[model samples]
Target: MGNNFKMIAKTLFGFEELLAKELRNLGAGNVKEGVRNVAFEGDLGFMYKANLCLRTAIKIIKPIQSFPVRNENDLYRKIYHMDWFEYLSVDTTFAIDATVKSDNFSHSLYVSQKTKDAIVDKFRDTDGKRPNVDVKHPDLRINVHIHKETCNVSLDSSGSSLHHRGYRISTNIAPINEVLAAGLLLLSGWDGQCDFLDPMCGSGTMLTEAAMIACNIPANINRKGFAFEKWTDFDEALYEKIIAASLKKTREFHHMIIGMDKAPSAIRKAQENIDNANLTDYITLKRANFFKTTKETEGPLHMVFNPPYGERLDRSDLDSDFDVEEFYANIGDTLKQEYPGTNAWFITSNLHALKFVGLRPSRKIKVFNSHLESRLVKYEMYEGSKKAKFQKS
Candidate 1:
């Protein structure tokens, strides 16, 4: 507790609250929400746990210093004076990731160049040598952000974003990111209590994430590694302990997790990925056309998926002879006529095609699928009857 310090977890636009809640659940202190980010206080072990467990966060960064800078020279001087030897040395290879949202600094690349020059010069003056810059795989990844006149320097603890969750080595076209998949399930209020299904499951990302959430498994438990592993102060024993403790906290999931897709290729890929994650026992995969099938699980089925939104309003997942309008309408028909007693949720960027669904969405949330602005919608289907329970307009 005495070693706790402020850390920032960066997330997608609509996931700020979700990330904050996750931090608080993980026992973070002074949790606060920011735009596309959540700030909290935690120690080194908590930092490791957050990186391993957070499903919505893209990166966890530890701020080392902050100051006011008037120009590039000011930035260079301030960054040069920091204790570089504490994190890097003459033999270390580092990279600077710069972001400029300021009227003062026009170019992030220029800022990165100046920061790099200052560090190299400081090292050369002291030891007559400097570390080389490795952009692809760096020993130390420094974050430089300039907003208005304030400059904040941080260390990137999670490399290559938390979305690279080491599972789903096989992916379909534009497969949902692991982080986004987990966020969607969480947003839909899925808690492993009921049977879960991804009707249009692609590459089994949603299925894998759902299984993990259901069983209390860590989000990045399968990740190859994090940037913190390369830091000079990394503690292997402590990290092992954190992992062991997290695994021990995992609860048993008795409910079923199912994944279905029309494409046999998709089913094969999903199964392979699921097996890779050691979740084969927890998830069931099959090749079935969702529109042609009815719910097999009894009692309180939960569904979350992303239907085809078409490629830039051009090619869609439907057959060339089939129309996109009919594709979306079928999704509505299946939910209203077949999947009763379920909370059906899906995301799509095609707002115009959504009108063809006919049924009114119980909830519509604004979110982003990659860069495209989209909506995550919910439609409730009660158990009494098909047409009567699922309200159709």
Candidate 2:
């Protein structure tokens, strides 16, 4: 109970509940879900923990002020009167990031410009100097979010997208996003109980995330830094303590995690990334066509992968005749014929090609892969045969 404040953890579409659950598990109070975001209550130490451990969150923002605004002038007037000295100094570089969902504020860029102007003007009049604006790298990143008539201004606690986990030194052309990979694993009910596989694991994102989940490691443990570290009130000793505590909670994972790719280059990149994450001990990578492989492990298997979506794969990968339909059909054939007792899930935006997989998905969850509207489809290969599936279905 040390100066608790409300904060918003933003995420991809359809991940609000997951983020909310993560917050509650992390001891956040008053947890609530919103569209693509979750609001919760926590103090500064908890903020550090959230940034370090939240697997589904992209960015967390701490709201500093809120008010009603009709036009840009109202925004400027309101922003100018705030006591900026508390959070920012004349020597500190800052940036404004604005998102508007209102008819009053037509363009977000305009809103950002106006807010920057107000803040700089305030400093110029008061202290006879102004902080410079740095978009790429800034000491203080301000966030302005407007919905209808109310404007909410906040501090961006996570600078870049938390998906930059600092371990991906090399990647394939169609590398899956780290945050999306982690969320997909969570949604697939992958709790690291059984053996895990990513058959078409291009850059081994799913494999790495699976190992982290299995080991109970912090999601961003490999991440270099968070924005809060640059804040004026950042406590270095407290952050170190939090890191040590999180690492202490990590438990031993007994199950195997595997990644397979057809391309040699992909295997090489995945090996580099896994090594960078210090997960080479927990993950195994092989260069093999997934359709040619069978279930090599015993017991139930958890499989999640991002297959070639017909768009982003390397040119060499798609240089052949590359029949999209037959490619997916082979996927179904292999899964149905080879792998059993596996809860196999994969995401794709190519709906037309997805239908060619033949087998109907047991669960289809709508999601977004960056800008593409995608579906994370699950096809459960029963340990038993047609009788068991028919009864369950």
Candidate 3:
């Protein structure tokens, strides 16, 4: 094994624990959780594996330098002193993404500019030529985060957000984010142990993520590339070995995975995405109203979906004649009456509409969908005459 180094895997809100657990399971050392991020120690190969397998991590960054800076000149001086040639070349293009949470530095753009100037000046002084900045498609992506006078500079290992799983070529209005979908699936404990269904599988993001989780497939197996591929120290043979090892660990999924949507267009788009993921054999797509369907399989069913919350007034997914309360009531009614011996989980940002679901949720987990605070609620429907478990007020 190569020398171990520290890396930070960034995640969304309410997903720190999940990312930490995932890191630990992947044999990461010195795993520690922070606000919306997890720190860990691993060799370069493990970094590749983390980007490929971790469902919740938005980006994995390798910190190159950290220092205290009270002013822009101090920041520039600290950055200029670093060995920029170790990471970037005169031919390489780069970009900076900065985040500031400090009273000392109020503008992130200025911080980014200062950092860029420092790096470029150092290169021009040493080699007489500096790498050009390409904000759109950078050969190397850098991250600068300042928190209360502390500045941390890191290299972004993932170029685009990890949510771009590459399989979702088609999408409907208000499609769920891929990371949120996978996290919700993991939270719901959908282990491919039983039959699975997504009632309102718009654009099939959730369904694709669920299928990958159930099959133990690498989340980014279909992704085009990572920023690490552009790194000077990247090892292609090592990454290939890691990919092969991960593929060897993929277990077989025996049960059926079903996705249903009322819109035929949604069904078509979902099918395209599923096919793009090459998961057609494992998932079945249907165009049917969720409220009109009943359980088709005999075994215990694991249902996870994202129903319309009437939160986005202009969303096309919302029927032209949508009724929020009545729709939620119908969802509650359908699950209670039709899906016996089942566990149904859904996320919604509409608190008012959620209240109209009639049955109290057994579990209401706090989560966020973009800027909207949301809840992932669970309802357990018992078989026969057993009472369904409901949450108490």
State the lDDT of candidate 3 residue by residue for 1-393, as single tens digits.
Answer: 459999999999999999999999999999999999999999999999999999999999999889998999999999999988899999999999999999999999999999899999999999999999999889999999999989999999999999999999988878899999999999999888999999999899988998899999999999999999999999999999999999999989999999999889999999999999999989999999999999999979999999855464465646678788899989988988899989999999898888788887889999999988999999888887764454322
lDDT per residue for candidate 2 within 272-313, as digits (tens), equals 989999999999888899999999999999999998655656
TM-score of each: 0.97, 0.96, 0.97
* Pairs with backbone N, CA or C atoms under 3 Å apart (clashes), candidate 3: none
Candidate 3's error at 338, in angstroms? 0.5
Ranking by lDDT: 1, 3, 2
Which lDDT value does model 2 have at 308? 66
Please give the RMSD to the true structure for each candidate, in Å: 1.4, 2.0, 1.5
Off by over 4 Å in 1: 312-318, 389-391
Measured on C-alpha atoms, candidate 2 has an lDDT of 0.91
Off by over 4 Å in 3: 313-317, 388-393
lDDT of 1 at 17: 90
Superposed by TM-score, candidate 2 places the C-alpha of residue 112 at a distance from the truth, in angstroms, of 1.3
Quantify all predictions' global Cα lDDT against the true fold: 0.92, 0.91, 0.92
lDDT of 1 by residue, 109-190 (tens): 9999999999999999999999999999999999999999999999999989999999878988788988898999999999
Pairs that collide in candidate 2 are none
